[model samples]
Target: MTSTRTRLTPEQRRGQLLDLGVRLLATRPLDELSIDVLAEEAGISRGLLYHYFGNKHAFHEAVVRHAADDLIAQTAPPASGPPLERLLTSVTAYVDYVIANREGYLSLVRAAAGGNDRLREIYEEARAVLTDRVFREDPEGHILLDTPAARLLVRGWSALTEELVLTWADDPAGVTREELLDLIAGSLPAVAALAR
Candidate 1:
């Protein structure tokens, strides 16, 4: 079997691996993203897969980090305003990014939820930042009960965002961005009052 030890340019190899990993998630569940299949598809042998990622879980962790960086980079809001304003900007930015990376993000979601506890832990940690931002923006908002609550809510929102975006991914006509944002925004009042 082909491995990903050094099949292409390093960046290309990495891209190929990540592409394989993320795309595999769509056809199969995250836990089902076999390293053998991944190596085969990427034109690398299983050994290279190991050489590149150490193992499937390590590869997954790398994917998670890459995806999170993309998210954090894409959604980082203006830092000179109320937390809520910053949050709104960040969320909208995030929605746009999610719309852009639905497949990859959803893949990670499935993998994180259906695979390792470590994966789940990492996802929750990233998710908590969003909750913290939300709470900071609109203190005592409806969300923010605990880390789990934040993960659940953020994941819920992400799932919704993915589903809606996926449905509209190729279509020209669908829920406008404003409408989607409004739906998310509408829940703010309750979230703001969550712990009250």
Candidate 2:
């Protein structure tokens, strides 16, 4: 049978492949998302995949970077709203993002912890962006984060939120989504206040 696949521009094809990688990542670790599998799914030869990404590691990095960017974009705070309301909005989006991308998020965390310097850097950069958002959106956060100790406390709070959200995603433990959001969003000031 003659192939009837539509031709895509180089950039379009590369983007299409990356999108597929991101979707597949939703269920498997980056390490297990082999080039062969991606090629088969894309209906392209492995050589063509390498032609686009140069190598497996490069492809993995591209997929991870896309995922991180998507997560950050999805969780961005509203440009204008009541401070507390904005925080809760972002937190709600974040919780929803992680729950929907649970396996992908977990795999990203595992990749960072697996001693890959580049992946770790990508993960840390995403965390830093999120931490900075908390400070930027919280009306009192600027004053609270004036000192080095205060900033550290906020970062710690970010970690706490991450752990709680991940745990809650796995098992709610009788906590309602609203309760979890309120707990995470409401605890920031108290956590940041420890620096005072």
Q: Which model scores highest in lDDT?
A: 2
At residue 22, what lDDT does model 2 achieve? 88
Tens digits of lDDT, candidate 1, 26-115: 455455667888877877689988888887778877767667655767777676675456666876887787666666667666656675
Give the Cα RMSD of candidate 2.
2.8
lDDT of each: 0.65, 0.86
Model 1 Cα displacement at 160 (Å)?
A: 6.9
- Candidate 2: stretches off by over 4 Å: 1-7, 137-143
Candidate 1 ranges beyond 4 A from true positions: 1-49, 137-174
Taking every candidate in turn, the Cα RMSD to the unseen true structure, in Å, is 6.6, 2.8
lDDT of 2 at 153: 85
* lDDT (Cα, tens digit) per residue for candidate 2, span 20-85: 998988888788898999999988899999999999999999999889999999999888777777
